[model samples]
Target: MSSARENNPPAKTGAARKARPLKTRTYGLFRWLHVYISMFSLLIVLFFSVTGITLNHPDWVFGNVETRQEYSGTLPEGWKTGNQVNWLKVVEHVRATHNVKGSVADDGYQSDEQQASVAFHGPGYAADVFIEMGTGKYTVNVDAQGAVAVMNDLHKGRDTSPLWKWVIDLSAGFLTLVSLTGLGLLIFLKKIRPAGLITAAAGGVLVLLLMRLAS
Candidate 1:
């Protein structure tokens, strides 16, 4: 009986076989998630990466031409009430007359100088209005930065709308998901796991070294 058991090995047990199928299914699910999520986020990743390069080297000129326009106008006297400047009327008038597109970033009145300044900011765009509180005479200066500047601002979520901020957050979540699933898939590949982990560690160390050098 001992010789027969040694020769046959009693055929592999069901419990061990079941464990393999569960592991394989889990691995397959993670792989599927990794592939699809990566595909969906590819464009977003490319945009951010390219913008990152542009951001890091601001002096790397992309011929970003800034065009400035100056216009002189007179505002209605009713736009101001006593010592206070009516900001709402001023902004509306600027938007209607000059076709300005941006949110008001600053609105201040200098009582001594009898002047008021209103500034608007948007992605790669700025508009400033200086007004003589008494005469209502105003000067508008509008600056439009080139396309590259706009894209960079969008990537950084600088002066962007809340909707765009949401997009950045969602993209970050997707990237996190992709990374975790990718690491999970590597665990199932025994032969490559050691090399993969080493490579990942090396990448992390390189980033840390670069940050240290930068500081």
Candidate 2:
């Protein structure tokens, strides 16, 4: 008679054998994404990081913090017909005369108290116009808040255009993807994953504790 051990061979684990390759593919995908996304976001990451430091310290004066100029000019005759001021022409004249820029502020166009005020605001620039009702003459104050201020303003999205705001949102999305992929890649690193996860957890806790203490 054949030996009992020889009569029944061990059962083959075909499904389990297939699972190993699938797990490897998953790990490879994460690694690929992490590497490419990090390269792609490198510039954006650096920009935000450097600007973050400058933003945290508002008192750090760099470049001309502000430059003020006063301009006085007479509007064209067509701008004012008695008390009914042709506000459109008035605004245009100021812009054309002084090379003023930026979109008009929300409350920038107001006609009250026998005078009209028109204002424009940009990332780090401002222009305010005051026109006397009787005469078509006007005075404007322009303020330039320099390059550093402009960078800070861009970081905060104070008065950027719709396109630039979209850029900010897209950059944020890319950063999130890079971070998630990095963490995913770490999970696949069986040799270092346990220590890596513990370090990450501890770092997060430290940040939370710092925030609480700061507040």
Candidate 3:
């Protein structure tokens, strides 16, 4: 039995199998691919990541954003000083004077308050104009510039040209590919990549939480 065992090939143990050297070429290829993809998308990645951080800590990043915009425009023809106001002339006048890239449509009228309102959605923002028919004064409130708002609006292709939207969609697809390749490389080196599992689990949880919250 001893002679037969000696002649037979030794069974490979886990340690022996693990001790086998990693393929340098395969490792190099993965690293090269990762580096190239990261370099190609560096700017977009940086922008999105920074914006993410900023969004997470909004108070620190956006405490000083503008909140209101008020402009006085003289009423044009068919508009009255004290009589009931016309919304079409107001919208056209505001677009001409203040560069409002939106159409003004009738929102509603309040009988008790004797007021009329119009709504406008622009490239980066939306505004509702409320005019106190009795006072002949208008008040406009604008939202704070937020990272999520900016990112989401970009994702929705709001007011963007068709070509720009296409670019964003293509870049998003490339980002997914890069991320997947990185995860695969990580799986191959999990044993030596200290804290790799922990880091990956944490990242997965974070993504899930963020997506849930966003949805």
lDDT of 2 at 39: 91
Report the C-alpha lDDT of model 3 over 157-193, residue by residue, as the tens digit.
Answer: 6645667678777778768878877876786795856
User: 57, model 3: CA deviation in Å?
Assistant: 1.6
Model 1 residue 170 CA deviation in Å:
1.5
Clashes of 1: 0
lDDT of 1 by residue, 1-215 (tens): 99998888866777766455788899999999999999999999889888888888877668578999998899876787886888888889989999998776433323435788888888889888999877889999999998778888999998778899999999999989999999999989999999999999999999999999999
Model 2, range 1-215, lDDT digits (tens) per residue? 46876998767788755455877998899889889888988987777777799899888897737999999988888886666778778878888889988888667788865788888888998889988876767899999998888988888788779887887887898899988998998998899999999999999999999999999
Return whichever of 1 and 2 wins on lDDT. Answer: 1
Residue 193 lDDT (model 1): 100
Q: How many backbone clashes does every candidate have? A: 0, 0, 0
| CA-RMSD of model 3 | 11.7
TM-score of 3: 0.50
Q: Model 1's lDDT to the true fold? A: 0.86
Off by over 4 Å in 2: 1-20, 80-85
List where candidate 3 sits over 4 angstroms from the true fold: 1-33, 61-63, 78-90, 101-114, 121-126, 131-171, 186-215
The best-first sequence of candidates by lDDT reads 1, 2, 3
Using lDDT, give the best candidate's number: 1
